[model samples]
Target: MFEQGDWGSAADWAVAPVDHSRLKHPVQALTAMVLVARQENAAAAQKVFTAVCAYRMGIAEDFDRLGEQAADWLGVGAEMEVALVLGVSVGTARKLISVGVTLDTRLPLVKAAFVAGELDFSRVRTIVDAVDGVSEATVSAVEAAIVDAALQRPPRALANEIARLLIAANPDDAAESRKKREKHSRTVKITPDSHGMAALFATMTAAEGVVVSTRIDEMAATVCRRDPRTPATLRTDAFVALINCETHLACRCETADCPFAHLPAAEPATVHLHVHVDVETLLGFADNPANLEGHGPIDPDLARRFAQDATWQAIVEETRSRCPAKAHPAGFVPTATKLLPPPVPSGIGGAIADIKAAIDADPKVLDGEFPDGHGGLDEPPPGALSYRPRKEVKDKVYAKYSTCTFPNCYVPVRKCQFDHIEPFDHSDPERGGWTIESNGHPACPYHHQAKTDGIFRVVRMAGDAIVWVSRNGAVGITIPEELGGSHEPEARKPVKLTRPAPAEDPPDDAIYDPTWWEQHMQSGDRPPTLADMAQLTDRRLAVIYRELGTHYEEHLAILAARDRHMPPPY
Candidate 1:
């Protein structure tokens, strides 16, 4: 060691800074490799997989380009893989194809326009029904955007891009738009007819603050006059709304004689349950005038006659009793107990077994039509609740936790579950129940367990971003660049509470239009629009002849050809 200078002349060596730029591509490639290796990151792989498979399938250049850009190449590859492995049926093929196409692009938004109600695609749809939407050109443009985004980023990023495209191009039907705009404004008031109408009148406060002193029969007549073919579902639903608005049954007496006597003054006043009715049988009553016991088919003109009766009001105002209501005993069903038949015959496993059997047989025969999973739906699965609450719940979980809540794990929502920051069971019912609102936090199960097992604790700071304090008392706030907005779980970014920045002069290129490259290559060459993406996919599949044997032979031949062409590495 003392003779180092004499032995090595100070060990002169030039340690040049390694050029990391050359390694960037390989790093990205390796990152992608790791991503595709996992089943959860299949969405990213799907884009590339679909594109490559489409090229193999002899798809058109235009569409192959689309597939490549959208990275639907991986998806198509998976489909072929499934078909080859599982011997997928024609119906299954159709379904998978539809889903693949929809998920590969922003097409669901277009198809959603023609359907009534919320933009939910869970209902059944005919193939013909699926095609109903805006013009093809618009949809193609949207898909193009999705494909562009897919090529640039990962699956979640692609979805965000698709969402942005949808917002920019509102593809909703004109009629649907008008209806949506008019929905809250179109108000109607009607009084439901029941024995003892006075009691119902007294409960008017319980109604939706919507009360009309007129009979439902009269209201139905008025609605009929507006639209000749009033559907029964609509009529019944409207009646339910009317009842929700104007009917309340209360008992002043706290004695055992009254059914509601056990409840204190602060207790819930009304217990609402679904009233079931058989439509066909009810309609049968409408067929015969003589079938109406003393009264004709609910004459609208007779509302005045009934409204003047004091006996009806007295009965309506009376207290609840053990005796159920006298209305349509045979036809009416308790609302809650009617629609879904009180869970399955047994537990979840039984229901699942039944579903499996249905799948083996005809699924239609089992669960009726599929309640959700419409032909070309693309929206993410809603979590926990069927309906999202009106106000934004700060601690509410996302449909999925898109990113790793653990400071280290950046796994996305597709592989995530809600994490209760404070263990849910910690809240005693004796004190208060744990609700999904404040107690729930979206996290991958692994990270959630880590948080729960006294390793870490998650807290939402002022900016709504999650901050974690480790058991060792190390404080680390996840920066946005390290992950994405999944940790925040808000629909939009919260307004910055910091003081506004001073206005700066706009750059000369601030409002610059698209360049020639953008106009021709970048923007124009985006994948098909959301509306046209599915149809185009179907059309491509229809023409691409599924020559399984030919494909297999071709694949083998290609492997052989590659063997002949390539030199073996030592």
Candidate 2:
């Protein structure tokens, strides 16, 4: 029975009243907030769906009056209007309209549940999508079967349940639909991300994906344990190596004793990865960022590494003004100088010329196209090594510890050195301390040195946890990884750490304190108005807007019905 104005102020609609002091745990507070937020979000979405339905109904009236010719134009205009208001793409708006219509027309129960906050948007979208091409008779049954589970399950689980029920309802149609999707929907796409990285997305049959993943894992595992790359990173490198037709990942340990170190480098792939860098940065004179093809700007250091094996090409920028010449009476040369390719361009001047050539090429080259055959674009340079640990010992240590053993340190175990807890008897092997799994712990170089220099002390404790005592007497504890147990003797009377008390909750005024907003405005920023705040709170203004749209749609329908009944003027 809420009226248009009953929703109150934008702040009232947006902020939920949660007594944080009443919640015993942070998790309880968070859970309460999430539930309230979901309810508000659902309410907002229901308003949007209501508005969209009404808008489309009014448009339908125009379509009927103006005939079928105006359908496309009206539809495009409608999508654009929604897109502008939502600040989303036309395609997204179209999808939203379609989902809204589906929810309004077919799945009334789902819509009710959605507005009541029992089902989230993703679950509703999943149900709507699953029933898209389904026969009307079967879809209702599918909706009824899954709506209860959809309330409790995640979107993915809900999708699976929906799929299972769909197949059960009509197995033949489901099989045919899946077959059509597999034939037409398989695609490989690369999307650019921030920080000079790109995500490669591929939609293929599950079997094909499994095959690719297994092959990558196999190739990644071929490297010795001393390789510094994490399993995930190694897998990625292995996938790239497979694309380049290489057998295995090159061990990055870089030690002369490494099994893969002495192996000859694999021949470069025909596909070249182009990098655009400035002349100064290429020559190591500057540290400016360089753009990798497809990917965005990468560190200059990474660019230099790419340059080591890259083929050189020079492209000099030309000026409109002609150079001076002794042959001409005008004392200038009309033709520009044609510079030849430098020999041994791997050196300083040659490297600079190479970079200039790369920069001058078509910007489309960034899309990973280079007709010229060049190799080693994807291969990373070998890292310098200090010491090497036994492969078995390193493997055991890595399996036991996923990250560095130093307190509060999260450096991946692959990137850490296996340090001997009790200094190894290098001079005499049988003199007690040995390079065994019981005595080894992974530590990053910095902390490894500190431990070796007595700046920090770590001792094995009861329950396979390591106690770290710092120089300042601040103590920290590290529990062993889940995969393995330690055989080392435990220390006596280990200190028991106490959990710190939670901080006092902030005063209610802090939620929408005007002091911070005033300060922001004082700093020459544009202060947001109520309308803007309402939009920021996910269309809280829709409370009033939905009411207006409903009345507008009703008026349009009445006009349409009256006009249809009226005699045409001849």
Candidate 3:
């Protein structure tokens, strides 16, 4: 049997072999050295060994965090933004918050707390607080809900592994409560460094979106044991378990004896902001599927950069380049260019031309051939030279006014129309034919009508200023800064009209061209309109109203018959 003296000496040996020279600080050096000896010590020295081991683990955690801070300074913080959108469904918002919490706990501090036997709600909150951009109020509220939920059940008695894992995986009811409270939680911490600002700015600018975890926590489920059955087994615990499983290969640690021996200190994961934008809202901006340039999958950082990039700015500039802006729904027109322009088309010269040509060439094309009440025109006369169908004009209109052709109307392509520069009735086929691409320019319907009815006129002034002559003759000279000092003449395409052959009764083959219809249908493609929506809704509501009306009539008729059968009152 081992004697007391032998046990005491063994314990002393376990605690006393610490080397101060090997560590930067005396306490840490002492702690690590003792742990090294304790691992080699016998069973008689178990208590001493455990103490040394705990101290050593504590020191290692401190050094690990120090290393993390160093890495952050070096721009190695694996970063991502977590945007909290304003008007999401409760369920989706909770999922996003849960994802945020999961990402928060991925920090070095939280993982270290788990290894050091100090994991709890307080520790988790601390982990959240450490993130640069997260608001303290938000974390505080979320932490409270998480703690309340954790304290409700028996599993709460176990270590925080289960709770932390749930924070990452199953933040359901608790997440909702936290999100509600977060409405009042608007404060965000700012970091002055590279990764910190990059993450914060990217998220804030993509305010309708946020960044989130890109790290796939494959080991978050199986290895994270917080139950009483595996309380003493550190390797079985989630913190250590993740490291042991080669699931996250990049974050795997190689040390054998340390508590964090398997958990590798690695970068943070992140997701994009646009991915979380409301689906219908995103769809509302896409006029044509082909004009949907920034739609679909994108990285949060990349999406913001794209928004602020020169190319996107150029497209916006081009679309709204020459159109007059109408008053907003509140009956106010914006004078500022700060806010992102709405996706509406603006260039109106082409749309005016197209409408006039429809009226002039085939007065019937307005309500007859095109028949969607396209142009306000009367019937075609005998031997009248009718215009090309509206669909033909629409195709060219889309190509010329890729977006809004107006100087400042960047509405989408589908929202715009082709207008004539000179009224089609007045347009000289000899000077520049109606079909000449340059004769018509694209414009939004509002501006199209405004310009066509002579509410506005486009003409050159003394300089490069394009003067807008109002209906009341008050001229507003729009001196475009971009076009300063240039007065270029309008370029017109020379027209060539062929004489028609002596008409016999025109054959159906002479007019109904299959290629023309095919091309027209392909070109006038706009997203579902208010009219389409109204039609569907009307059909649905008609059935409902008809049933209700019939029910009321039957009941009234029965009552009237009963009254007729009853004796008359004195």
TM-score of 2: 0.46
Tens-digit per-residue lDDT, 287-351, candidate 3? 21122221222333433333332222111112223443221121112231232534553333443
Show how many residue pairs clash in every candidate, following the order shown. Answer: 41, 0, 38
In model 1, which runs have C-alpha deviations exceeding 4 angstroms?
1-98, 101-132, 150-267, 272-570
- Evaluate model 3: give its TM-score: 0.20
- Please write out the lDDT profile of model 1 over residues 1-570, one tens digit for every residue: 012445465235322334546556777768654433433333323433353354345234324445455343323332323332234432343454554354334354433331222111222122212223434554565654544444455444444555456546665642343345344334443233344121123223213334443344433443322243445644453454456663322333334555544534333325421111112122221111111111112332232233222121110111111243232111112221122222222322333233334334542231211112121123222332322322233222342123554444445434566554434433342122133333344567655654654445665421224445443233333322211112322222223223233335432331133322233334324322212221222433322222221233333334333344443461
- Tens-digit lDDT track of model 2 for 217-253: 8989878999998888998999899988898776888
Best by TM-score: 2
Native-referenced Cα lDDT, model 3 = 0.35
Better of 1 and 3 by TM-score: 3
Prediction 1 TM-score vs. true:
0.18
Residue runs of model 3 more than 4 Å from their true location after superposition: 1-389, 420-439, 458-468, 472-487, 490-494, 499-570
lDDT of candidate 1? 0.35
Q: Which candidate achieves the best lDDT against the true structure?
A: 2
Root-mean-square deviation of every model: 36.8, 35.7, 31.0
In candidate 2, residue 447 scores what lDDT?
A: 64
